[model samples]
Target: MAKPQIYDVLHREHEEVSELFHQLEEAKGAEALELFARLKQKLVPHSRAEEAVVYPRLLEESNTADTTREGIEEHKQVDKLLAELDAMTPDNEVWQAKIKVLADMVGHHVDEEEGELFPRAKQVVSDQEAEQLVDEYARERDSFVEDIRLEQRDAAE
Candidate 1:
Protein backbone atom coordinates (compact mmCIF):
# COMPACT_ATOMS: atom_id res chain seq x y z
CA MET A 1 0.00 0.00 0.00
CA ALA A 2 1.22 3.52 -0.74
CA LYS A 3 2.03 5.56 2.33
CA PRO A 4 -0.29 8.39 3.13
CA GLN A 5 0.71 11.73 1.67
CA ILE A 6 1.90 14.36 4.11
CA TYR A 7 -0.51 16.78 2.54
CA ASP A 8 -3.37 14.43 3.27
CA VAL A 9 -2.49 14.31 6.95
CA LEU A 10 -2.04 18.06 7.16
CA HIS A 11 -5.21 18.73 5.21
CA ARG A 12 -7.20 16.53 7.54
CA GLU A 13 -5.78 18.37 10.52
CA HIS A 14 -6.77 21.65 8.89
CA GLU A 15 -10.34 20.40 8.62
CA GLU A 16 -10.28 19.32 12.25
CA VAL A 17 -9.05 22.71 13.32
CA SER A 18 -11.81 24.36 11.32
CA GLU A 19 -14.33 22.17 13.13
CA LEU A 20 -12.90 23.23 16.49
CA PHE A 21 -13.15 26.84 15.41
CA HIS A 22 -16.82 26.31 14.61
CA GLN A 23 -17.29 24.69 18.00
CA LEU A 24 -15.70 27.71 19.61
CA GLU A 25 -18.12 30.02 17.84
CA GLU A 26 -21.09 28.12 19.30
CA ALA A 27 -19.68 27.89 22.81
CA LYS A 28 -19.36 30.36 25.66
CA GLY A 29 -17.10 30.89 28.69
CA ALA A 30 -15.38 27.71 29.83
CA GLU A 31 -16.69 25.71 26.91
CA ALA A 32 -15.25 28.21 24.45
CA LEU A 33 -11.98 28.20 26.33
CA GLU A 34 -11.90 24.43 26.14
CA LEU A 35 -12.51 24.50 22.42
CA PHE A 36 -9.75 27.04 21.96
CA ALA A 37 -7.43 24.83 23.96
CA ARG A 38 -8.25 21.91 21.70
CA LEU A 39 -7.56 24.06 18.66
CA LYS A 40 -4.22 25.04 20.06
CA GLN A 41 -3.43 21.42 20.84
CA LYS A 42 -4.14 20.41 17.27
CA LEU A 43 -2.44 23.34 15.58
CA VAL A 44 0.81 23.90 17.40
CA PRO A 45 2.54 20.66 16.57
CA HIS A 46 1.03 20.53 13.14
CA SER A 47 2.54 23.89 12.37
CA ARG A 48 5.86 22.92 13.81
CA ALA A 49 5.95 19.69 11.83
CA GLU A 50 5.18 21.49 8.60
CA GLU A 51 7.67 24.27 9.18
CA ALA A 52 10.43 22.06 10.49
CA VAL A 53 10.24 19.12 8.15
CA VAL A 54 7.89 19.52 5.23
CA TYR A 55 8.43 23.10 4.12
CA PRO A 56 12.18 22.82 4.08
CA ARG A 57 12.07 19.72 1.95
CA LEU A 58 9.62 21.29 -0.44
CA LEU A 59 11.68 24.42 -0.67
CA GLU A 60 14.80 22.44 -1.49
CA GLU A 61 13.36 19.86 -3.82
CA SER A 62 10.60 21.70 -5.59
CA ASN A 63 12.62 24.88 -5.93
CA THR A 64 9.40 26.66 -5.24
CA ALA A 65 10.99 29.26 -3.05
CA ASP A 66 8.23 31.80 -3.57
CA THR A 67 5.50 29.44 -2.47
CA THR A 68 7.46 28.29 0.56
CA ARG A 69 8.25 31.89 1.43
CA GLU A 70 4.60 32.79 1.29
CA GLY A 71 3.81 29.84 3.51
CA ILE A 72 6.34 31.01 6.11
CA GLU A 73 4.74 34.44 6.11
CA GLU A 74 1.36 32.85 6.63
CA HIS A 75 2.79 30.85 9.51
CA LYS A 76 3.98 34.05 11.14
CA GLN A 77 0.56 35.59 10.78
CA VAL A 78 -1.14 32.52 12.24
CA ASP A 79 1.34 32.28 15.10
CA LYS A 80 0.80 35.91 16.05
CA LEU A 81 -2.94 35.39 16.14
CA LEU A 82 -2.52 32.19 18.08
CA ALA A 83 -0.34 33.94 20.65
CA GLU A 84 -2.92 36.64 21.06
CA LEU A 85 -5.69 34.08 21.45
CA ASP A 86 -3.68 32.20 24.02
CA ALA A 87 -3.12 35.25 26.17
CA MET A 88 -6.69 36.52 26.33
CA THR A 89 -9.76 35.17 28.06
CA PRO A 90 -12.64 33.89 25.93
CA ASP A 91 -14.95 36.52 27.42
CA ASN A 92 -12.89 39.35 25.98
CA GLU A 93 -14.32 40.90 22.84
CA VAL A 94 -10.84 41.50 21.52
CA TRP A 95 -10.06 37.83 21.93
CA GLN A 96 -13.12 36.88 19.96
CA ALA A 97 -12.14 39.20 17.17
CA LYS A 98 -8.63 37.84 17.14
CA ILE A 99 -9.93 34.31 16.93
CA LYS A 100 -12.01 35.24 13.92
CA VAL A 101 -8.96 36.73 12.30
CA LEU A 102 -7.06 33.55 13.05
CA ALA A 103 -9.73 31.46 11.41
CA ASP A 104 -9.55 33.58 8.28
CA MET A 105 -5.79 33.52 8.14
CA VAL A 106 -5.71 29.77 8.65
CA GLY A 107 -8.36 29.25 6.02
CA HIS A 108 -6.22 31.10 3.49
CA HIS A 109 -3.11 29.26 4.57
CA VAL A 110 -4.81 25.89 4.24
CA ASP A 111 -6.06 26.75 0.78
CA GLU A 112 -2.59 27.74 -0.35
CA GLU A 113 -1.04 24.59 0.98
CA GLU A 114 -3.67 22.28 -0.36
CA GLY A 115 -4.11 24.06 -3.66
CA GLU A 116 -0.58 25.10 -4.47
CA LEU A 117 2.14 23.58 -2.32
CA PHE A 118 0.91 20.00 -2.16
CA PRO A 119 0.46 19.65 -5.90
CA ARG A 120 3.87 21.17 -6.60
CA ALA A 121 5.47 18.97 -3.95
CA LYS A 122 4.01 15.82 -5.43
CA GLN A 123 5.59 16.69 -8.73
CA VAL A 124 9.02 16.79 -7.11
CA VAL A 125 9.21 14.16 -4.38
CA SER A 126 8.90 10.45 -4.97
CA ASP A 127 6.53 8.23 -2.99
CA GLN A 128 9.39 6.85 -0.88
CA GLU A 129 10.68 10.31 -0.15
CA ALA A 130 7.21 11.51 0.70
CA GLU A 131 6.81 8.61 3.10
CA GLN A 132 10.12 9.41 4.74
CA LEU A 133 9.14 13.03 5.12
CA VAL A 134 5.87 11.99 6.69
CA ASP A 135 7.67 9.68 9.06
CA GLU A 136 10.04 12.43 10.14
CA TYR A 137 7.12 14.82 10.54
CA ALA A 138 5.30 12.33 12.79
CA ARG A 139 8.31 12.09 15.09
CA GLU A 140 8.67 15.86 15.25
CA ARG A 141 4.96 16.29 15.83
CA ASP A 142 5.07 13.85 18.76
CA SER A 143 7.90 15.78 20.37
CA PHE A 144 6.05 19.02 19.83
CA VAL A 145 2.96 17.61 21.52
CA GLU A 146 4.98 16.59 24.57
CA ASP A 147 6.48 20.03 24.82
CA ILE A 148 3.09 21.68 24.62
CA ARG A 149 1.73 19.36 27.30
CA LEU A 150 4.57 20.27 29.61
CA GLU A 151 3.97 23.95 28.98
CA GLN A 152 0.26 23.55 29.61
CA ARG A 153 0.92 21.76 32.88
CA ASP A 154 3.24 24.50 34.01
CA ALA A 155 0.75 27.18 33.08
CA ALA A 156 -1.98 25.36 35.00
CA GLU A 157 0.04 25.40 38.20
Candidate 2:
Protein backbone atom coordinates (compact mmCIF):
# COMPACT_ATOMS: atom_id res chain seq x y z
CA MET A 1 0.00 0.00 0.00
CA ALA A 2 1.18 3.52 -0.75
CA LYS A 3 2.05 5.66 2.21
CA PRO A 4 0.14 8.85 2.83
CA GLN A 5 1.52 12.17 1.63
CA ILE A 6 2.28 15.10 3.91
CA TYR A 7 -0.80 16.89 2.62
CA ASP A 8 -2.91 13.87 3.53
CA VAL A 9 -1.55 13.84 7.07
CA LEU A 10 -2.05 17.57 7.66
CA HIS A 11 -5.38 17.70 5.90
CA ARG A 12 -6.69 14.76 7.87
CA GLU A 13 -5.67 16.44 11.12
CA HIS A 14 -7.36 19.66 10.02
CA GLU A 15 -10.62 17.85 9.38
CA GLU A 16 -10.41 16.00 12.67
CA VAL A 17 -9.81 19.22 14.60
CA SER A 18 -12.67 20.91 12.82
CA GLU A 19 -14.99 18.08 13.81
CA LEU A 20 -13.67 18.19 17.38
CA PHE A 21 -14.42 21.91 17.50
CA HIS A 22 -18.01 21.18 16.49
CA GLN A 23 -18.24 18.60 19.24
CA LEU A 24 -16.74 21.08 21.68
CA GLU A 25 -19.38 23.65 20.84
CA GLU A 26 -22.12 21.27 21.92
CA ALA A 27 -20.30 20.03 25.02
CA LYS A 28 -20.67 21.47 28.54
CA GLY A 29 -18.81 21.20 31.83
CA ALA A 30 -16.66 18.07 31.95
CA GLU A 31 -17.58 17.21 28.37
CA ALA A 32 -16.23 20.53 27.21
CA LEU A 33 -13.07 19.96 29.16
CA GLU A 34 -12.63 16.54 27.66
CA LEU A 35 -13.34 17.79 24.17
CA PHE A 36 -11.02 20.75 24.54
CA ALA A 37 -8.30 18.48 25.79
CA ARG A 38 -8.78 16.27 22.75
CA LEU A 39 -8.68 19.28 20.45
CA LYS A 40 -5.46 20.49 22.02
CA GLN A 41 -4.05 17.00 21.89
CA LYS A 42 -4.42 17.09 18.10
CA LEU A 43 -3.62 20.75 17.45
CA VAL A 44 -0.45 21.48 19.38
CA PRO A 45 1.44 18.50 18.12
CA HIS A 46 0.19 18.98 14.57
CA SER A 47 1.50 22.53 14.51
CA ARG A 48 4.83 21.49 15.94
CA ALA A 49 5.10 18.61 13.53
CA GLU A 50 4.38 20.84 10.55
CA GLU A 51 6.97 23.30 11.75
CA ALA A 52 9.52 20.58 12.27
CA VAL A 53 8.98 18.66 9.04
CA VAL A 54 7.13 20.78 6.49
CA TYR A 55 7.76 24.52 6.97
CA PRO A 56 11.53 24.37 6.84
CA ARG A 57 11.36 22.49 3.59
CA LEU A 58 8.98 25.03 2.17
CA LEU A 59 11.32 27.75 3.43
CA GLU A 60 14.00 26.43 1.07
CA GLU A 61 12.27 28.02 -1.88
CA SER A 62 12.31 31.80 -1.94
CA ASN A 63 8.78 31.96 -3.34
CA THR A 64 7.21 29.73 -0.71
CA ALA A 65 8.90 31.31 2.29
CA ASP A 66 6.33 34.03 2.86
CA THR A 67 3.43 31.61 2.85
CA THR A 68 5.37 29.20 5.02
CA ARG A 69 6.12 32.02 7.44
CA GLU A 70 2.52 33.15 7.42
CA GLY A 71 1.34 29.66 8.25
CA ILE A 72 3.70 29.51 11.23
CA GLU A 73 2.55 32.92 12.39
CA GLU A 74 -1.05 31.75 12.20
CA HIS A 75 -0.12 28.77 14.32
CA LYS A 76 1.36 31.15 16.85
CA GLN A 77 -1.87 33.10 16.97
CA VAL A 78 -3.86 29.91 17.44
CA ASP A 79 -1.50 28.87 20.21
CA LYS A 80 -2.17 32.14 21.99
CA LEU A 81 -5.90 31.59 21.66
CA LEU A 82 -5.54 28.02 22.83
CA ALA A 83 -3.65 29.21 25.89
CA GLU A 84 -6.35 31.74 26.66
CA LEU A 85 -8.99 29.05 26.26
CA ASP A 86 -6.99 26.79 28.51
CA ALA A 87 -6.83 29.42 31.22
CA MET A 88 -10.56 30.03 31.40
CA THR A 89 -12.87 27.92 33.51
CA PRO A 90 -15.34 25.92 31.44
CA ASP A 91 -18.15 27.57 33.37
CA ASN A 92 -16.94 31.08 32.49
CA GLU A 93 -19.57 32.98 30.55
CA VAL A 94 -17.05 34.11 27.94
CA TRP A 95 -15.56 30.70 27.30
CA GLN A 96 -17.89 29.55 24.55
CA ALA A 97 -17.82 32.91 22.82
CA LYS A 98 -14.06 32.90 22.77
CA ILE A 99 -14.04 29.33 21.52
CA LYS A 100 -16.17 30.38 18.57
CA VAL A 101 -13.53 32.91 17.65
CA LEU A 102 -10.85 30.27 17.98
CA ALA A 103 -12.81 27.98 15.70
CA ASP A 104 -13.07 30.71 13.06
CA MET A 105 -9.37 31.40 13.25
CA VAL A 106 -8.60 27.74 12.79
CA GLY A 107 -11.03 27.39 9.91
CA HIS A 108 -9.44 30.30 8.07
CA HIS A 109 -5.99 28.92 8.69
CA VAL A 110 -6.96 25.51 7.41
CA ASP A 111 -8.50 26.98 4.28
CA GLU A 112 -5.31 28.88 3.50
CA GLU A 113 -3.21 25.82 4.11
CA GLU A 114 -5.18 23.36 2.04
CA GLY A 115 -6.02 25.83 -0.69
CA GLU A 116 -2.65 27.50 -1.11
CA LEU A 117 0.13 25.99 0.90
CA PHE A 118 -0.44 22.37 0.02
CA PRO A 119 -0.75 23.07 -3.69
CA ARG A 120 2.28 25.35 -3.70
CA ALA A 121 4.21 22.82 -1.70
CA LYS A 122 3.88 20.32 -4.51
CA GLN A 123 5.96 22.65 -6.62
CA VAL A 124 8.54 23.12 -3.87
CA VAL A 125 8.69 19.65 -2.36
CA SER A 126 9.30 16.59 -4.48
CA ASP A 127 6.97 13.60 -4.28
CA GLN A 128 9.60 11.56 -2.44
CA GLU A 129 10.22 14.33 0.08
CA ALA A 130 6.53 14.82 0.75
CA GLU A 131 6.14 11.12 1.39
CA GLN A 132 9.12 11.06 3.74
CA LEU A 133 7.87 14.10 5.61
CA VAL A 134 4.57 12.39 6.30
CA ASP A 135 6.24 9.73 8.39
CA GLU A 136 8.40 12.28 10.15
CA TYR A 137 5.44 14.50 10.89
CA ALA A 138 3.51 11.57 12.29
CA ARG A 139 6.41 10.58 14.56
CA GLU A 140 6.85 14.10 15.89
CA ARG A 141 3.13 14.53 16.46
CA ASP A 142 2.66 11.16 18.09
CA SER A 143 5.60 11.59 20.46
CA PHE A 144 4.32 14.96 21.61
CA VAL A 145 0.83 13.51 22.06
CA GLU A 146 2.20 10.65 24.13
CA ASP A 147 4.02 13.11 26.34
CA ILE A 148 0.82 15.06 26.84
CA ARG A 149 -1.01 11.90 27.81
CA LEU A 150 1.69 11.13 30.35
CA GLU A 151 1.49 14.62 31.80
CA GLN A 152 -2.28 14.48 32.05
CA ARG A 153 -2.19 11.08 33.68
CA ASP A 154 0.39 12.25 36.19
CA ALA A 155 -1.66 15.33 37.03
CA ALA A 156 -4.72 13.20 37.58
CA GLU A 157 -2.93 10.70 39.79
Candidate 3:
Protein backbone atom coordinates (compact mmCIF):
# COMPACT_ATOMS: atom_id res chain seq x y z
CA MET A 1 0.00 0.00 0.00
CA ALA A 2 1.17 3.56 -0.66
CA LYS A 3 2.01 5.85 2.20
CA PRO A 4 -0.66 8.36 3.17
CA GLN A 5 -0.08 12.00 2.41
CA ILE A 6 -0.58 15.02 4.65
CA TYR A 7 -4.15 15.64 3.53
CA ASP A 8 -5.12 12.06 4.24
CA VAL A 9 -3.95 12.32 7.85
CA LEU A 10 -5.57 15.69 8.30
CA HIS A 11 -8.81 14.46 6.78
CA ARG A 12 -9.03 11.64 9.26
CA GLU A 13 -8.40 13.94 12.17
CA HIS A 14 -10.97 16.40 10.88
CA GLU A 15 -13.58 13.68 10.65
CA GLU A 16 -12.84 12.54 14.19
CA VAL A 17 -13.03 16.05 15.58
CA SER A 18 -16.32 16.66 13.78
CA GLU A 19 -17.77 13.48 15.20
CA LEU A 20 -16.62 14.38 18.71
CA PHE A 21 -18.33 17.73 18.42
CA HIS A 22 -21.48 16.12 17.14
CA GLN A 23 -21.52 13.70 20.05
CA LEU A 24 -20.88 16.56 22.44
CA GLU A 25 -24.00 18.33 21.29
CA GLU A 26 -26.20 15.58 22.67
CA ALA A 27 -24.06 14.82 25.71
CA LYS A 28 -24.70 16.10 29.22
CA GLY A 29 -22.61 16.80 32.33
CA ALA A 30 -19.79 14.26 32.53
CA GLU A 31 -20.40 13.00 29.03
CA ALA A 32 -20.11 16.48 27.60
CA LEU A 33 -16.96 17.11 29.56
CA GLU A 34 -15.44 13.87 28.35
CA LEU A 35 -16.31 14.66 24.77
CA PHE A 36 -14.84 18.14 25.12
CA ALA A 37 -11.62 16.74 26.52
CA ARG A 38 -11.30 14.33 23.64
CA LEU A 39 -11.93 17.12 21.17
CA LYS A 40 -9.28 19.28 22.79
CA GLN A 41 -6.76 16.46 22.81
CA LYS A 42 -7.24 15.90 19.09
CA LEU A 43 -7.63 19.51 18.00
CA VAL A 44 -4.93 21.37 19.90
CA PRO A 45 -2.17 19.08 18.73
CA HIS A 46 -3.48 18.92 15.19
CA SER A 47 -3.51 22.69 14.95
CA ARG A 48 -0.08 23.06 16.48
CA ALA A 49 1.43 20.38 14.26
CA GLU A 50 -0.16 21.77 11.13
CA GLU A 51 1.17 25.17 12.06
CA ALA A 52 4.58 23.66 12.56
CA VAL A 53 4.76 21.42 9.51
CA VAL A 54 2.09 22.31 6.98
CA TYR A 55 1.31 26.01 7.30
CA PRO A 56 4.91 27.09 7.14
CA ARG A 57 5.37 25.28 3.87
CA LEU A 58 2.14 26.63 2.49
CA LEU A 59 3.00 30.12 3.68
CA GLU A 60 6.21 30.06 1.68
CA GLU A 61 4.43 29.78 -1.62
CA SER A 62 2.47 32.69 -3.12
CA ASN A 63 -0.52 30.60 -4.08
CA THR A 64 -1.10 29.16 -0.61
CA ALA A 65 0.22 31.87 1.72
CA ASP A 66 -3.00 33.83 1.96
CA THR A 67 -5.12 30.76 2.60
CA THR A 68 -2.66 29.51 5.17
CA ARG A 69 -2.84 32.80 7.03
CA GLU A 70 -6.61 32.61 7.00
CA GLY A 71 -6.47 29.10 8.41
CA ILE A 72 -4.15 30.20 11.23
CA GLU A 73 -6.50 33.02 12.13
CA GLU A 74 -9.38 30.58 12.21
CA HIS A 75 -7.35 28.45 14.59
CA LYS A 76 -6.98 31.44 16.86
CA GLN A 77 -10.73 31.99 16.85
CA VAL A 78 -11.40 28.36 17.64
CA ASP A 79 -8.86 28.46 20.44
CA LYS A 80 -10.61 31.43 21.99
CA LEU A 81 -13.93 29.61 21.91
CA LEU A 82 -12.26 26.54 23.37
CA ALA A 83 -10.78 28.56 26.16
CA GLU A 84 -14.16 30.01 27.02
CA LEU A 85 -15.69 26.57 27.01
CA ASP A 86 -12.92 25.29 29.22
CA ALA A 87 -13.55 28.02 31.75
CA MET A 88 -17.17 27.03 32.20
CA THR A 89 -18.63 23.75 33.39
CA PRO A 90 -20.51 21.65 30.85
CA ASP A 91 -23.74 22.29 32.73
CA ASN A 92 -23.48 26.00 32.24
CA GLU A 93 -26.30 27.31 30.07
CA VAL A 94 -23.90 29.07 27.77
CA TRP A 95 -21.77 26.02 27.09
CA GLN A 96 -23.99 24.62 24.39
CA ALA A 97 -24.28 27.88 22.56
CA LYS A 98 -20.55 28.42 22.69
CA ILE A 99 -19.83 24.92 21.49
CA LYS A 100 -22.18 25.41 18.58
CA VAL A 101 -20.25 28.50 17.56
CA LEU A 102 -16.97 26.65 17.89
CA ALA A 103 -18.29 23.80 15.78
CA ASP A 104 -19.43 26.18 13.07
CA MET A 105 -16.05 27.88 13.02
CA VAL A 106 -14.22 24.58 12.80
CA GLY A 107 -16.52 23.30 10.09
CA HIS A 108 -15.93 26.41 8.01
CA HIS A 109 -12.19 26.18 8.46
CA VAL A 110 -12.11 22.53 7.52
CA ASP A 111 -14.18 23.20 4.42
CA GLU A 112 -11.82 25.92 3.30
CA GLU A 113 -8.75 23.89 4.08
CA GLU A 114 -9.85 20.79 2.23
CA GLY A 115 -11.32 22.78 -0.65
CA GLU A 116 -8.77 25.51 -1.09
CA LEU A 117 -5.53 25.02 0.80
CA PHE A 118 -5.03 21.35 0.00
CA PRO A 119 -5.52 21.89 -3.69
CA ARG A 120 -3.14 24.85 -3.64
CA ALA A 121 -0.64 22.85 -1.64
CA LYS A 122 -0.77 20.09 -4.21
CA GLN A 123 0.10 22.58 -6.86
CA VAL A 124 3.18 23.90 -5.06
CA VAL A 125 4.47 21.05 -2.86
CA SER A 126 6.04 18.10 -4.57
CA ASP A 127 4.72 14.61 -3.75
CA GLN A 128 7.92 13.89 -1.81
CA GLU A 129 7.45 16.99 0.28
CA ALA A 130 3.84 16.11 0.99
CA GLU A 131 4.85 12.65 2.18
CA GLN A 132 7.60 14.13 4.35
CA LEU A 133 5.04 16.50 5.90
CA VAL A 134 2.84 13.57 6.92
CA ASP A 135 5.65 12.16 9.03
CA GLU A 136 6.71 15.51 10.40
CA TYR A 137 3.17 16.52 11.36
CA ALA A 138 2.52 13.22 13.12
CA ARG A 139 5.75 13.53 15.09
CA GLU A 140 4.99 17.08 16.16
CA ARG A 141 1.41 16.22 17.06
CA ASP A 142 2.50 13.18 19.08
CA SER A 143 5.01 15.31 20.99
CA PHE A 144 2.25 17.75 21.93
CA VAL A 145 -0.02 14.94 23.11
CA GLU A 146 2.78 13.47 25.22
CA ASP A 147 3.49 16.81 26.82
CA ILE A 148 -0.20 17.21 27.67
CA ARG A 149 -0.35 13.72 29.14
CA LEU A 150 2.70 14.36 31.30
CA GLU A 151 1.29 17.64 32.51
CA GLN A 152 -2.02 16.05 33.40
CA ARG A 153 -0.26 13.23 35.22
CA ASP A 154 1.82 15.66 37.22
CA ALA A 155 -1.23 17.70 38.13
CA ALA A 156 -2.96 14.62 39.43
CA GLU A 157 0.03 13.67 41.59
Candidate 4:
Protein backbone atom coordinates (compact mmCIF):
# COMPACT_ATOMS: atom_id res chain seq x y z
CA MET A 1 0.00 0.00 0.00
CA ALA A 2 1.10 3.53 -0.73
CA LYS A 3 1.91 5.78 2.17
CA PRO A 4 -0.38 8.68 2.95
CA GLN A 5 0.62 12.16 1.81
CA ILE A 6 1.55 14.92 4.26
CA TYR A 7 -1.24 17.06 2.91
CA ASP A 8 -3.76 14.32 3.67
CA VAL A 9 -2.74 14.20 7.33
CA LEU A 10 -2.59 17.97 7.71
CA HIS A 11 -5.92 18.47 5.98
CA ARG A 12 -7.63 15.91 8.19
CA GLU A 13 -6.21 17.54 11.29
CA HIS A 14 -7.49 20.88 10.02
CA GLU A 15 -10.99 19.44 9.78
CA GLU A 16 -10.75 18.03 13.28
CA VAL A 17 -9.61 21.39 14.64
CA SER A 18 -12.49 23.08 12.85
CA GLU A 19 -14.91 20.73 14.58
CA LEU A 20 -13.34 21.58 17.92
CA PHE A 21 -13.88 25.26 17.19
CA HIS A 22 -17.56 24.55 16.49
CA GLN A 23 -17.79 22.64 19.73
CA LEU A 24 -16.24 25.57 21.55
CA GLU A 25 -18.90 27.88 20.21
CA GLU A 26 -21.75 25.62 21.36
CA ALA A 27 -20.23 24.63 24.72
CA LYS A 28 -20.74 26.27 28.12
CA GLY A 29 -19.00 26.30 31.52
CA ALA A 30 -16.62 23.41 32.09
CA GLU A 31 -17.54 21.88 28.72
CA ALA A 32 -16.47 25.03 26.94
CA LEU A 33 -13.21 25.07 28.84
CA GLU A 34 -12.66 21.45 27.91
CA LEU A 35 -13.30 22.18 24.22
CA PHE A 36 -10.90 25.10 24.37
CA ALA A 37 -8.29 22.86 25.94
CA ARG A 38 -8.76 20.28 23.19
CA LEU A 39 -8.42 22.99 20.56
CA LYS A 40 -5.11 24.06 22.05
CA GLN A 41 -3.95 20.47 22.34
CA LYS A 42 -4.62 19.77 18.66
CA LEU A 43 -3.54 23.14 17.31
CA VAL A 44 -0.18 23.59 19.02
CA PRO A 45 1.35 20.40 17.70
CA HIS A 46 -0.26 20.73 14.27
CA SER A 47 1.10 24.23 13.83
CA ARG A 48 4.49 23.29 15.19
CA ALA A 49 4.80 20.36 12.86
CA GLU A 50 4.02 22.56 9.87
CA GLU A 51 6.50 25.18 11.05
CA ALA A 52 9.19 22.65 11.89
CA VAL A 53 8.89 20.44 8.84
CA VAL A 54 6.54 21.67 6.12
CA TYR A 55 7.00 25.44 5.88
CA PRO A 56 10.78 25.36 5.64
CA ARG A 57 10.62 22.75 2.94
CA LEU A 58 8.11 24.82 1.00
CA LEU A 59 10.30 27.89 1.37
CA GLU A 60 13.17 26.00 -0.19
CA GLU A 61 11.32 24.46 -3.10
CA SER A 62 8.37 26.69 -3.98
CA ASN A 63 9.12 29.88 -5.84
CA THR A 64 5.67 31.18 -4.97
CA ALA A 65 5.97 31.89 -1.29
CA ASP A 66 2.99 34.15 -0.81
CA THR A 67 0.57 31.52 0.39
CA THR A 68 3.01 29.91 2.77
CA ARG A 69 4.07 33.29 4.10
CA GLU A 70 0.46 34.21 4.73
CA GLY A 71 0.00 30.91 6.50
CA ILE A 72 2.95 31.68 8.76
CA GLU A 73 1.56 35.09 9.59
CA GLU A 74 -1.75 33.47 10.44
CA HIS A 75 0.07 31.05 12.69
CA LYS A 76 1.60 33.94 14.59
CA GLN A 77 -1.81 35.57 14.98
CA VAL A 78 -3.30 32.31 16.21
CA ASP A 79 -0.42 31.87 18.64
CA LYS A 80 -1.06 35.28 20.11
CA LEU A 81 -4.76 34.51 20.55
CA LEU A 82 -3.96 31.12 22.05
CA ALA A 83 -1.66 32.71 24.60
CA GLU A 84 -4.33 35.27 25.50
CA LEU A 85 -6.93 32.56 25.84
CA ASP A 86 -4.60 30.53 28.02
CA ALA A 87 -4.27 33.40 30.47
CA MET A 88 -8.05 33.96 30.63
CA THR A 89 -10.80 32.18 32.48
CA PRO A 90 -13.82 30.95 30.54
CA ASP A 91 -16.14 32.92 32.80
CA ASN A 92 -14.82 36.24 31.46
CA GLU A 93 -16.80 37.92 28.68
CA VAL A 94 -13.56 39.10 27.09
CA TRP A 95 -12.33 35.54 27.05
CA GLN A 96 -15.37 34.42 25.08
CA ALA A 97 -14.86 37.21 22.57
CA LYS A 98 -11.22 36.34 22.23
CA ILE A 99 -12.08 32.71 21.62
CA LYS A 100 -14.54 33.76 18.92
CA VAL A 101 -11.81 35.78 17.25
CA LEU A 102 -9.52 32.78 17.44
CA ALA A 103 -12.11 30.58 15.81
CA ASP A 104 -12.56 33.02 12.96
CA MET A 105 -8.84 33.45 12.47
CA VAL A 106 -8.26 29.70 12.47
CA GLY A 107 -11.11 29.10 10.02
CA HIS A 108 -9.63 31.61 7.60
CA HIS A 109 -6.16 30.19 8.04
CA VAL A 110 -7.28 26.65 7.29
CA ASP A 111 -9.20 27.76 4.22
CA GLU A 112 -6.16 29.53 2.85
CA GLU A 113 -3.88 26.59 3.47
CA GLU A 114 -6.25 24.07 1.96
CA GLY A 115 -7.11 26.24 -0.98
CA GLU A 116 -3.73 27.76 -1.84
CA LEU A 117 -0.70 26.46 0.00
CA PHE A 118 -1.41 22.78 -0.32
CA PRO A 119 -2.12 23.02 -4.03
CA ARG A 120 1.11 24.93 -4.62
CA ALA A 121 3.01 22.48 -2.48
CA LYS A 122 1.63 19.58 -4.45
CA GLN A 123 2.96 21.11 -7.63
CA VAL A 124 6.51 21.17 -6.28
CA VAL A 125 6.80 18.13 -4.01
CA SER A 126 6.73 14.63 -5.51
CA ASP A 127 4.46 11.95 -4.05
CA GLN A 128 7.44 10.20 -2.45
CA GLU A 129 8.65 13.46 -0.96
CA ALA A 130 5.16 14.10 0.34
CA GLU A 131 5.15 10.73 2.04
CA GLN A 132 8.52 11.40 3.59
CA LEU A 133 7.27 14.72 4.85
CA VAL A 134 4.27 13.00 6.37
CA ASP A 135 6.58 10.74 8.34
CA GLU A 136 8.75 13.62 9.51
CA TYR A 137 5.73 15.73 10.41
CA ALA A 138 4.24 12.92 12.51
CA ARG A 139 7.48 12.52 14.43
CA GLU A 140 7.74 16.26 15.05
CA ARG A 141 4.10 16.39 16.13
CA ASP A 142 4.66 13.63 18.70
CA SER A 143 7.70 15.44 20.11
CA PHE A 144 5.70 18.66 20.35
CA VAL A 145 2.90 16.89 22.19
CA GLU A 146 5.36 15.50 24.73
CA ASP A 147 6.93 18.91 25.30
CA ILE A 148 3.54 20.57 25.78
CA ARG A 149 2.45 17.87 28.24
CA LEU A 150 5.61 18.40 30.27
CA GLU A 151 5.06 22.15 30.30
CA GLN A 152 1.46 21.74 31.41
CA ARG A 153 2.55 19.45 34.22
CA ASP A 154 5.15 21.98 35.36
CA ALA A 155 2.63 24.79 35.21
CA ALA A 156 0.17 22.82 37.32
CA GLU A 157 2.74 22.17 40.06
Residue pairs whose backbone atoms clash in candidate 4 = none
Query: What's the TM-score of each model vs. the native?
Result: 0.94, 0.95, 0.97, 0.95
Q: Report the C-alpha lDDT of model 4 over 1-157, residue by residue, as the tens digit.
A: 8789999999899999989988888788899888888888899999999999999988876554777787889999999989888887888889778888998999898888888888888899999999999989999999999998998899899
True lDDT of residue 91, candidate 3: 80
lDDT of 2 by residue, 54-150 (tens): 8998998986889889999999999999989989878999999988999999999999899988888898788888899988888989998898899
Best by lDDT: 3
Of candidate 1, the 10-residue stretch with the lowest lDDT total is: 57-66
Q: Name the better of 1 and 4 by lDDT.
A: 4
Better of 1 and 4 by TM-score: 4
Query: Better model by lDDT, 1 or 2?
Result: 2
Report the lDDT tens digits of candidate 3 across residue range 81-131: 998998999889899999999999999999999999999899989888888
Highest TM-score model number: 3
**Where in model 1 is the C-alpha error above 4 Å?**
none
Q: Which residue pairs clash in candidate 2?
A: none
Cα-lDDT of candidate 3: 0.93
Which model, 1 or 3, shows the larger TM-score?
A: 3
Residue 15 CA error for candidate 4 (Å)? Answer: 0.9
